[model samples]
Target: MSHIFPRHSAQSYPVAVGGEGCYLIDDTGKRYLDGSGGAAVSCLGHGDPDVTEAIKAQLDQLAFAHTGFFTSAPAEALADLLVEHAPDGLDRVYLVSGGSEAAEAAIKLARQYWVEKGAPSRSRLIARRQSYHGNTIGALSAGGNEWRRAQFGPLLLNVSHIAPCYEYRLREAGESAEAYGLRAANALEEEILRLGPDTVMAFMAEPVVGATAGAVTAAPGYFKRIREICDTYGVLLILDEVMCGMGRTGSLFACEQDGVAPDIVCIAKGLGAGYQPIGAMLCTAQIYDVIAAGSGFFQHGHTYLGHPAAAAGGLAVVSAILQRGLLPRVQEKGDALHARLMEQFKQHPNIGDIRGRGLFRGIEIVEDRESKAPFDPSRRIAANIKKAAFEAGLICYPMSGTIDGKHGDHVLLAPPFIISDDQLDELTDKLSQALNAVI
Candidate 1:
């Protein structure tokens, strides 16, 4: 018996011993194609020499440095590189260990910014339903995934959740995608008015909703209008790009495709590409200036805020994404993957919608395509599909509670940028097998 505390206490899992390009090897030597990049973290696939070398070199020089006392070169360089390519107005970076830390920091920073700006009343937050930010208390409260928040309701801070800009189910029958997006975006304004704009500090959302909603992109003009509303209300827009940023969504920053730059942004997952755990929260110059001019400290921290080796790994991963021309490649390959998924499942009776951008795609499963009704929660459709995919030698991300917190199912596909055409076919073939075995 193992002494480790597993994610699922009752379920047993195969031991992952090693990984290559896009496949993970189990203890028994079974090669499972990594269809989801292990929750969209390994963008460069299992092993990359460049990132490893950088981390190793940094460790040899200096493995750790507490931020309370000093800042290291790797941390400084990483911050500079991130800001250089970040969206306009985002001029500062706060490095952390992972997505949860990033989200926590973003929340605190938003609140503090308002306080420093003489708006302490702006302490409330607003987010979208069916969105997943991170797992920390503050992040969890900001996230609208009900299933994840149910048990912790007593401890969570109060947050207003508006309807998600999900076109598949939320858009009316005759509404155009663009019109539906505007209507959806207006919900934020309504909520802000209901809560009073001055009482709200930030509006947080994933650029491409991940995990909970499974790669759900906003309808056209949704984010643009959202940005406008934030500006009008003096509310900060915080984009959580934890699972969809980096090069996973074709663009280095997912918000770029939406043509909107947020006042603050949280990024992780693909930032370090599974080489080292790293995430960052970036803010605009205006937000930074207010705090700098007021207290000179943001008043939030973590022990590993800027670990030298983790910073080195993130620096290398980001450099590889930019220098190797992976951004365009992600776009090209994303189109290919989307086309292949459509070709394979578009006509199927059970597959309701196949959507996403870049290498990040999602397949919503429905009992009836016309009604878009989900499989019964008791059926455990997502869990079974995941098991079947794993058994078929493919590693895919399937999740329950897609529509609400308990009604729908979806499989999120986020393969590495280096995935080849042949591998794409392999992925589709194995996914078909899994679906056949399940639904």
Candidate 2:
């Protein structure tokens, strides 16, 4: 009997004793391929020497320095590197501990920005349905995932939700992808008008939907239209790149590929490459200036904000990614991985769709291909697939509630950037076995 509390106490779990390259080893000495990088955190894979060394070096020198008192070299350097690589106008970085923290900071910053600019009425937030910002209260209120928000509805602040740009399920038969994209993106405009444009502070979304929707990508021109809407309404665009940014999408920032620069962006998970927990919210110079000139302070701080060791790990991870030219490699491997998945599942009746970009891919499951019907939620297809994959020496990220709050299932694949072709082949093989055994 273990004294430690677990995520799910009803079920036992393997103790992950060690990790190397793209695989994790259990206490029993079994190696499981990290197919989803533990929810897309380990971009450089496990046991990265450079990142580990950076963390250790930072710890040796100094571990904690409160932001109110001082700023460390690692924090400054990390911020500089991130800004240099960030989208145009995004000149400031507010470092935080993880995805939820990043989201919380972004929300507060947006509200503060509006207030500083004399738009105190801009307090409402609009996000897409089926999207996930984070788990904290403020972030949770901004998120639109039904299951996650259902129980917390009473406690959550009022936030509006519009339809997401999910083309596969929502796209009409006669509609071109571009047309559907425009239609979906137009939902924001309608929502803004309904809520009174002056009252809305920001519109939040994940450039590439992760976890909740399983690596879903927006259609062409979708984000361009979204950017246009934000600008037209004076609404700040906040892109939550917690799972898809930092080279996971084969681009430094996923929004770059979409050719749109958000006013505020939240990033995490892959930022530190699982070497250390770190996340940051980047905002435009205009927003920063408004708050700086108005309040002379942002009115937010965390005990671990600008943590030296985490910043060091993030800096090292970004440095290694750029030095090794891993972004292009992610694109190349992603192409190979997509091809392998298509080849393997193209003929499978239960596999409904295979889509995504770079190392992040999703395999949507269905009971009938023609109808695109989901399996019974009670059947727990995604859960069974995850268990089967793990038992077969592969760790995957599978989740239910894909269609809404309770209906669909998808397996999200986000292998480490360091994964090889052979490892991809292994991933597909194990996935096929898991699907066959469970689905």
Candidate 2 C-alpha lDDT tens digits along 320-357: 98999999999999999999999999889999999999
**Which regions in candidate 1 have their CA more than 4 angstroms from the true location?**
none
Candidate 1: tens digits of C-alpha lDDT, residues 181-269: 99999999999999998899999999899999888999999999999999999999999999999989999999999999999999999
lDDT of each: 0.95, 0.95
Listed in order, each prediction's TM-score against the native is: 0.99, 0.99
Clashes of 1: 0
lDDT of 1 at 270: 98
Report the lDDT of model 2 for residue 168.
86
TM-score, model 2 to reference:
0.99
